[model samples]
Target: MKTVSIRNPGMSWDIAANILVPPGFDEGKRYPAVISNHPIGSCKEQTAGNVYGAALATAGFVVIVPDASFQGGSGGEPRWLEDPEQRVRDYRDVVDYAQSLPFVDPERIGMLGICGGGGYSIKATIIDKRIKALVSITGVNFGRLMREGFSNFDPLGALEGMAAQRTAENGGAKEDINIFVPGSVEEAKAAGIKDIDVLGATDYYRNRCPAEGAGTRMLVSHAAPAVAWDAFAFAETLLTQPLMVVFGDKPGGFGAYRDGMEIYGRAASKDKELVVIEGWSHYDLYDNAVPTGIALDRLVPFFKRHLSDMPAGSATNPAEANH
Candidate 1:
């Protein structure tokens, strides 16, 4: 895997990314590629790159794990702004970058997104037909989650507060940044936060694996765009590409389980599958060995069947077969 910077032509910002080519990669031959997007407030080095990115490369595909613009190593002003529209566009920009590479097969590109990235990936695939196949793991539709409060938290009230904060920022006030998760599990418990998703995220981001340029923070004004955006909008009509929605049975306050079911029912893709792992929570799918292995087991074959030039069940690359 090698780190590279991809410039988003539409936004004029550079997206820092890690490109992982299959083992014994041959520049002379074109290979199917997959764009793996990280969760919100997470960078390429976390689950996107360190986990699935590495796994997919070994499974015989060129993988591109990119940090969302305005966050992590990507270049943009007003850092930590989580704009849903811009995040969706980031996929298109990465696709453009992937097509430019000599060793990548543009026609066989697929996408894999985890957490909030899953939502953005679905939205991106709706408009961008170049993404021929998609896999959404623990997909969270942010707009739906915001519209409906999480654990009885008032999102509408938060939206109003964000509006006032945006107005204040416009008038030379200091920017307001909000923590994405509790500082620690102890703090979360002390504050009476019983939401499993929130607690799991706190543990994962703060304890299990801490990555540079990745943390639980976002601009307060992000609510303006995020609250209004819908990642699964028009999915019933435009989401024609092969899709796989994987989620655990344990429902969390974040609504990934609900979103996964909704997308599975609404998607127009004639070729789609919904894989539900019993008992696992949203965060378990991130890096846990057993659940992650189950997800990859389904994802590898799905991508191979959809992205490869060979017959659906046939192994396209000998290296991938060994994995």
Candidate 2:
């Protein structure tokens, strides 16, 4: 595993990434590559990205996990802004760089996005034909989630609040609101949060995760762009790449599983599959060993089948694999 940097030609921003080569990597031979994307408000070192990158590298594919522009080591002004269009472009930028590599088989490139990143991947793959295969885990459509409450409590109220936030931003009041990440079990419980994501995220971020840049805080004014963006709006007809959508069958306080299933049904791809890891909550798939293992088990074969026509004996490097 090595840390690398690439400049996004379209955006003109530098993207920092962790590149994991196969144990027997050969610079002269071309091999399939996978771009692993982290969740929104997460860096490359976070749980899902790191785990997926490492797993795919061990499975004999080149994996690169990059921090999105404006977050972590990536270069962008107005830090922490969540622009869905820009996020989609980030995936394309990463693909552009990966295809330039001598060891990467450009036609066999694939992508795996976790959580909000999964949503962005859907939007990107629809327009960009470079990505041959895709995997989205616990995908959340931000536009739908913000327009209709996560649980469908009140749509009008949510829209009105977002409008008010935009108005405040236009008046020169900077909307830098920090979404709280529970630091302890007591704080999580005392917040009266019934959402399983809140509790699971609290534990993961507080103890297990390694990213210092991972947090719940965000720019409230970003609602302007997020409310207008729909991750699957263009996917019904344009998303023709082989896709695999994975999520826990049980909702468990998070509604993203429904969105994942909807994407699977809407995609036009003839080679598509939906895997439901029963009994696991949405956040459980983020980092928990058992659920993540189940996800990788399915993803490995999917990518191997879709990202085909590789040169014979591609994985012959002999160097030890690093996690």
- Cα lDDT computed for each candidate against the true fold: 0.88, 0.80
The C-alpha RMSD of each candidate to the native structure, in angstroms, is 4.8, 5.1
- Candidate 2 lDDT over 168-259, as tens digits, reads 87899777565646677568899787677767767777766746777555666555577667999867789999999999976844467889
Q: What's each prediction's TM-score?
A: 0.93, 0.89
lDDT of 1 at 235: 90
lDDT of 2: 0.80
Write candidate 1's Cα lDDT for 1-323 as tens digits: 88899988856679999999998999978888999999987899999888899999999999999999889999998899888899988889899888778777767899999989999999999999989999999999977776675313676787788989889999999988878888889999999999889999998999987898795678886557787789999999999999999999999999899999999999999999999999899999989999999999999999999997543323344334324
| Backbone clash numbers for all candidates listed | 0, 1
Q: Give the TM-score comparing model 1 with the true structure, all chains together.
A: 0.93
Question: What lDDT does candidate 1 reach at residue 103?
Answer: 79
